[model samples]
Target: MARIASEALIERLAEWGVDTVFGLPGDGINGIMEGLRRHRDRVRFVLVHHEEAAAFMAAGYAKATGRIGVCLATSGPGGIHLLNGLYDAKLDHVPVLAITGMQETSVLGTGYQQEVHLDRLFADVAEYNMMITNPAQLPSLVDLAIRTAYARRGVAHLTLPNDLQVAAADADPYEHVAPARPPQTAPVYLQPPGIPRQEDIEWAADVLNKAERPAILVGQGALHARQEVLAVAETLGAPVVKTLPGKAVLPDDSPYTTGGIGLLGTRPSEELMEETDVLFMVGTNFPYSKFLPEPGKARVVQFEADPVRAGARIATDVPVVCDAKEGLAALLPLLTPRDDSAHLAKYQKMMAKWRSDMRSLENPDRDPIAPQYAISVVDDLATDDAILTCDSGTIATWAARHWTIRGAREFYLSGTLASMANGLPYAIAMQHAYPDRQVIAYVGDGGFAMLMAEFLTAVQHRLPIKVIVNNNNSLGQILWEQMVLGYPEHGVRFAAPEADFSAWARSCGGFGAKVSKAVDVAPAVREALQHDGPALVDVDVNPNEPPMPGKVSYDQAKSFAQAFLKGQPHRAAIASTLFKDRIQRLGD
Candidate 1:
């Protein structure tokens, strides 16, 4: 109950339920470090080599545990380095509290050693940014920052001046702040001042009753409304198609759930949407507008939490601005139980056929190596409760298509940002946060190389993270796009000598292997899994094979061509790759 500045901060952090702190020590934050040492039994500080990795580690932990993940850094560059990871957490909506040390408060605006505008620099990435100048502000500021992070679901930065860390507070009285509670009643079901006209509900019910094949499209918002979504699907006897972000909202094996839709989606889901007369988009933005059927062809109904997102992607016959769960719950009672079990049965049959056909594409006999086959082998060798982190590009597509996620398993990725260089660090963080669970990173050569330096951090901590690099020596996604867009692929290839990733792993005092044939993949992965420390498996996969499962349209092809002609390299490549195989399939 002493009034020491560092102790007060630690006491406040403990009240916030922060059991683990990811960071390293520096002179500027030495007082806080000294306090942490004194209170070592109360809080555990996880040290990392780079401040950036520390922030990412916190982010991964927050995402997995659904709590505020905390990280700390010293003054100047140390604090600035945390920005990249903070930005990642901000974009992904992960709750993280980042505490950094600044130069002495006495030298405010004057040039001091390691002095920088830490508060202003973190403005864009943090929901709340404050520099604590007075000791009395510590308790309120800490409480406010924690509350803001939880409420906004983003990063909050707290900068402590070096002088403030040792400043004695006049009062040591600490008040506890309770965590935010989930709404008592679901937000969506609550009607505003004007009641919904009975006719509106009747019309929606009529549309459902008349349509022979109505498809349900679900997204991330469905996570909060799983029961409602299932209830609505069951009432209407409709097949549900989920987006990648909504993967586990419904059980993958549910008879009512066909799978994801769009470029990397399964054939049955795509076909079902194309054939359906009524498309109900629930809680999903589904960024690819080209994948959507024409609004006029199919009556579209949308339910979302935000009013602005109700009809952004497609024209909607009905748009409801309630929580996805609330909206579905309200609509469920109005719907008549359809006897069209046969309609749902047909879609189920088609889904089974799609799953069987896609399994054949994994070619265990391929010579160069199919990435999908490699993923299958890894899946087989991995623990049932393992955590899988995937990087962007071909590997992500392959993993999404092939990786089987059980209820016990946790899937973490930058799905919204779709950023590269996240796999290795993400795996390290997962291993750190959940030591008992096996953590694996499925990354491509391009992505792995981008954050290759983080491999040392894994080794330093002796984290048993297994990194599987799909080594194609090129950006596979870009190559597919170039072929589709009628452009000569340039700057996509890494013509430089390839690093021996296996040797690199060994150099860092961990297990490593280079897998060329399909037969060697499982054994290599098994060996890496058995290692006590970090490991890497560099698998050489076929560069020509496409990543996504489905095809694109003629309009998509045209858009890509226009972008390519204008020299928008990355955008053009994405457009071309997305539509390449679809164009070929149509031509045939």
Candidate 2:
């Protein structure tokens, strides 16, 4: 039987090992929908409420499994909705394939109904972007898109016109050149495992050996090199500091590691960067230069897979371009083990104090539940191998500090792009990838509200993921940012009659609970986790509570004071909250 281009495309995707496709259907993609129907047994189509969520789910799936994720959407606005999530995948360097339907080929130049110039729109976000004009191009285009996404570790895009999608998948009769292989045949593409130069390894080792206090910084790029990173840290008696995306690279319990670094990071990690004389960065291009050591103060060594990013963030004395696992493995054997424990011990002590201080702030006795306490309860209740994802906001800070990554647990967030509304979708993807494992989303009220409709998708699929909402009824992070940036809080708070997130979950055919008091946090979280299917626990947290930075500069303090003097809304409540928190910390 002769097949249409859409069916051939699905078959080609199946051959490329794609088991699932996350997307929303539309009129422009009727042919694709039929193809999916025909191949339902071989491929699962995850219907999403929004195209944006589909993109995020695809990116999340790729991140969790280290495989290419595919998301599809119809033409025009649907394709436009996918940009933010695609950019998230691009910035984080995750491989994702995005398929969009376009208006018929006859309307290419003319602005037909729902006709979007998708090729130009996706140019900046995609590593490879193309439109399939002929049925014959579907097979090769799909192959190229997948290979390019894998090779670049970013988003790849393909747009198929409505008419061309249903056309017969036969070569054009007028074609002049003969092909080497049949049109249906796809050549397998495998990325070579990168190996670093011996001299580069020796150079990195020499730099590490020469310094009295060396530090190791890891990122998502070094995720697969856990043992190698730990081994090198131990050899140099160095403290390992992770970027937020690399939080699970080493279990937080590891003796050689300090936690994350940056405004949302642990204090011990801040100190590690400040005191180290030599900094060995493993597969990380951490953006904030201020959080890094002074340019000339510390000699830098970077190991990265992308050569262009080797010395892009910080000045590098030695740059080793190779895969993180391979580079760290080779350099480990060349390093001389140090007997000094002073550097590692110092940070370990600092980490202990930080942990203690954090615990003090997690006060369960507070009238309105402390957000930290709520997250702590979830942390205590989550399974050993749970996959956790958090949205961008104050929730990010809370999760980073309180949630401990241990056992086989993995953590994800919008690390580089720092996009909101990603938590629920990421959780859904994680749940789909590992059916039996627990998947949880730690999201703020604002972020969750943005993509809250996705809860229905979770219920529709019978995904047993749990969502914990920090219901502050305000954009807590933005309010704090306004204060610290010398601006009065404006347009951040939600109107009265705060959302009943738990009720929404229950309405969507899932378990729901609301926790108003601090004491009820643990029981509520435990109940949600124990539920048979999807669940959401909305905790009414203290809105005035601030996500205090690891190290507050004098300018920041002055600006915060300035904002208060400038008549910031709810100034008195914020001040009272701040004063009480300080007194509590002092008493602790």
Candidate 3:
């Protein structure tokens, strides 16, 4: 029995363990769409507003679930729209499969309607890009597109010609190809392939055993290695600092935790690294080299799974190319737990005071509401198993500091891409992936407005995702950056009558609210969280409140002064806040 290529393709996707696909219906993709309709029992296609959002939703799904997220689109423009989100997946090192339908194979180069060079367009973003024109290529291509996504941990693309999609699958019946690794849904997911060499582990242990002030820097890779990382930290009595993506690697309330260490990071993390004699870089490639201690200042020992990224950012004194968990577990036996409590004690006191100061900020009785206060309220109310997504901007800074993720709670930022408007898309995917779990998107007004149309998608699907809008009325982070560079802020303001996102949500068959006063913030958030369907809570935030950098440079200081002289409003306020934040941390 010969099967239709499109049905075979959909069956192949189902066989690859993909249950949900994010995409839209277009005429060029009708064959694939029909295939989806036929396979409705096995796969569900999530309708999205734009092809870009579909791709972003796939990326978000992959990031949150650690599975191969799939997205579909038509030829030309639709294929182009997938690029940005595919890049997000690629740069962040997540597994995603992008399936695009092409114009007929016969008219590929004839400048036909909606025909474009998709392979060339997707080349830069996808690790594996292929075209399926022949029925025989359907099974292997779909398998490779899926397995390669998992194996490479990046984007894999498959372009199907509309003509071939509905054609006969094969002269013979189809067979399923088993993946090398067990699916995440299986009774047992595959373990890491290898561990570090004993010599490498021993060398790292020797360095840790000798150092007085050793620290652990974590990243997204540390998620699976939490126990091993904690063991290593406990043995050395080290303070663990986190990258933004690594924010949930260790709970902030944990004994060794020191929040994060970048522009949006904490003082304790910065101090911990600056004072560290030995820094064990674990599973993170925090790109800001300056945020790290000067090369000669700290002896670096890196425990990385990927050999390419082992020491790509900083100088590696001892490089252990192995799975972080496995490597740390092996090194534990060779390590000696230290008795020097001074280093750990010093930062612990500072972290304690920092937490205290942050508490006051979170409880501020400011007019038009402080961003931190509402976010902190969210922090307190979120369930331990909640899935939270944050947009890129000053709102991200507030969320980074205020929201404390622990237990089974998961946190996602855009990571390297840092693109705006990702929060809502991410939340949509999260809600779909884990419908039973609580999903929240902390989006800025700027970011939310960019992809505001996606709210309708959430409503259409009856997804119960809570969206919290930080209506700052400006590109807050960029304004701070401009001031820091001694340049007057330009094109940062959203002129006149702000966006009423809550009203838009209600129009789309969902609940909505707008909160401006301090008193209404918590209740609005609480209401949104408790809503049975998709909801949006829009809260007006002070535009002048800046999220300052961890360590100010001489040039940055000079620039701020110049901007102040140029009559930049909030100049003194930002400086005063920065000074107070640092000065108050000195006592502890």
lDDT of 1 at 349: 97
Cα distance off (Å), candidate 1, residue 386:
2.4
Task: Look at candidate 2 and tell me the lDDT of residue 462.
Answer: 98
Per-model TM-score on C-alpha atoms: 0.82, 0.98, 0.94
Clashing pairs in 1: 188-323, 481-577
lDDT: which candidate is best? 2
Better of 1 and 2 by lDDT: 2
Least accurate 10 contiguous residues by lDDT in model 1: 186-195
lDDT for 110 (candidate 1): 87
Cα error, residue 566 of model 1, in Å, equals: 15
Question: How many residue pairs clash per model?
Answer: 2, 0, 0
After superposition, the stretches of candidate 1 with alpha carbons farther than 4 Å from their true spots are 1-3, 111-114, 169-212, 224-228, 275-278, 281-283, 293-334, 482-485, 555-588
Best candidate according to TM-score: 2
Give the per-residue lDDT digits (tens) of candidate 3, residues 158-232: 998888888876622244643243333422225447588878888888888988899999999888888888888
Considering TM-score, which of the candidate structures 1 and 3 is the better prediction for this target?
3
TM-score result, candidate 1: 0.82
Clashing pairs in 2: none
**Candidate 2: minimum summed lDDT over ten consecutive residues — where?**
178-187
What value does the lDDT take at residue 175 in candidate 2? Answer: 67
Question: Clash pairs of candidate 3?
Answer: none
